[model samples]
Target: MSAPENREAFVRPPALELRGVTKRFGAGASAGRGARALDGVDLVLGEREFLVVLGPTGAGKTTLLRTIAGLETPDAGSVALHGRDARALAPADRDVALVFQNFSLYPSATVRENLAFPLAAPARRLSRAEIDERVAWAAKLLHVERLLDRPAKKLSGGEMQRVAIGRAIVRRPKLFLMDEPLTNLDAKLREELRVELRELARELETPVVWVTHDQAEALTMADRVALLVDGRIVQTGTPEDVYARPNSPLAARELGTPPMNLFDVERKDERWITADGVELARADAGAPERATIGVRPEHVLLDGGPSDAVVHVVEDWGPSRVLFAHVGAHALHVLAPRDCALRAGDRFRPTFDVRRVVVWPRA
Candidate 1:
């Protein structure tokens, strides 16, 4: 197929779509207190799109994933896969593959057996030769072919994860759902597998909805990320869009390494009059009258310009230095290159990167 036709052929509508999905737990007396796992959540995943869902524990990340995987039913909503109503189909019939956080492989099973299990489904009805072929293919794809004869119980966490991923891929499903598949691996292995997983997803040309609480994983792997909070999708966008232009304070807090420094400050005309009497020029003069002042640590400089402040603490974190300064009652952090010399108890004027400062309407 030509590039355009290949793209058209791959356009299989949305691999998954959720419309007004809501899930609530409990009853009247308990209902007033029950958790609302998902609230009117709506999302769409294009064919071959890799989307990650991020949220803290108890944020309903699992619930949302389960709903899509047919493990949990929403109280109110519709789930469609390839324009077909998904609620009508069972998990196996939906042509979806899910890899759980825990390597849920049978202890006695060898890697080959584990990879063959999904293909052995009655719906698949593949010949023994076909199953063996797919299992070998998947193991090769995940670089686990050498370990195909090893029992699941004897495999290392990373090796077992690869086997689990291999099993998922061997099914050749329309969509792949992963719930923190790399959470158990060591940092180095996790990083290695993350790259491999991305390549695998691309090579398979299947839509992937991966659930992860790790911001770095979500940012690095996803074509788009859906930030879930208390079961609601607070925001969804490309990593850069979500990080650079957070729609709310909650959304802003979810993305950054140290997170953006938010301070309740008074907005006077086109300037920010911090509680400590420091004045910050606003790049956007038409910002809300009373708003929160947000500036990332990297945007605050210790020297070479205007405002003055008393340093409270300086923390050395190898590659960079974080300076905690008191501007008044509010404490602000300034991230500086490690070579910059500044100490605690020192009073110095700091410069703000006006272009990077963000103003949000007071919450």
Candidate 2:
């Protein structure tokens, strides 16, 4: 290699990079052609960062991860890893590990055997002692040391997922690509694994690109979130930033539990008013004539305040209660404390903290 080439190679690049990435499927102009999975995606992942890719079905979350892992080639654009072009690199050569939603383990093999496979590969040529050490460490880290000798086929969904994750971590890859690894487990197990995975990522200091459709998981686990919609990145920011202050009403609706409550406010007499004639805050100077206001369920207050709505249904979630209310013709979802004395068919007033409300120009 030339001196300049060597110098360029030595310069640390982003852990993962995609420039103008585009991927489509099936026929180009068929009547029922396959959809475009990714559209001109430009993303950079920094070292030791946890970036969660969030979106609905067909939003291209899995496609982005596959492109990074070299499982799918882009129709256009470039992929680079650690300052090197990765377009030609095979999946194994990319120094990236992928953990799938299905816990894709060797079913016939023992947990220990599954964990050792990556380290014992012919290309790696690791000594048995080294491979054993790696397997032991991974098993211990994942709290699966007791189950190391158990067959993968006999384990529960959560246990198999832990083993699958152990296999990926045993190799100590430069990047981790996780595609809904916790989706298969029950809610309690999913929460347990989620916390463990976050700690493990921090301990290893490895860059990770996690793909999921769960809003709570994305908000809790991501250092930063990249929300993909219609094969494009609609927004990328910290969880609080994205939830509290969204660039668009669509982004706000996508992140919340029951989604944000959106209402079109009209500018009448220089005052913002809802359709129900409820008075909202004053309009901003540069704000358009009409704007959509988004308020989250947590921010929506349903106490002894103004009365523009009635309690439709109260859902008890143990520690929290979700009130589905009717404000005029609009349905409002509000999150409240479990001890609140509200129930079905009860009348109540819904107001929100103006500071927490998000306003977007109506289109």
Which prediction has the highest lDDT against the true structure? 2
Each model's lDDT comes to: 0.84, 0.86
lDDT of 2 at 99: 92
Report the C-alpha lDDT of model 1 over 200-309, residue by residue, as the tens digit: 89998999999988999999999999999888899999998888778877888877876788777677776677766676555466777677767788988776544567
C-alpha RMSD between model 1 and the true structure = 2.8
lDDT of 2 at 58: 84
Give per-candidate clash totals.
1, 0
What is candidate 1's CA lDDT for residue 41? Answer: 96
Q: List the residue pairs that clash in candidate 1.
A: 27-31
* Model number with the top TM-score: 1
Runs of candidate 1 with Cα error greater than 4 angstroms are 1-12, 26-33, 275-277, 304-307
lDDT tens readout by residue for model 2, 263-326: 8987676466777687645556666778898888888777544456778789998889999988
Q: Which ten residues in a row have the lowest lDDT in candidate 1?
A: 26-35
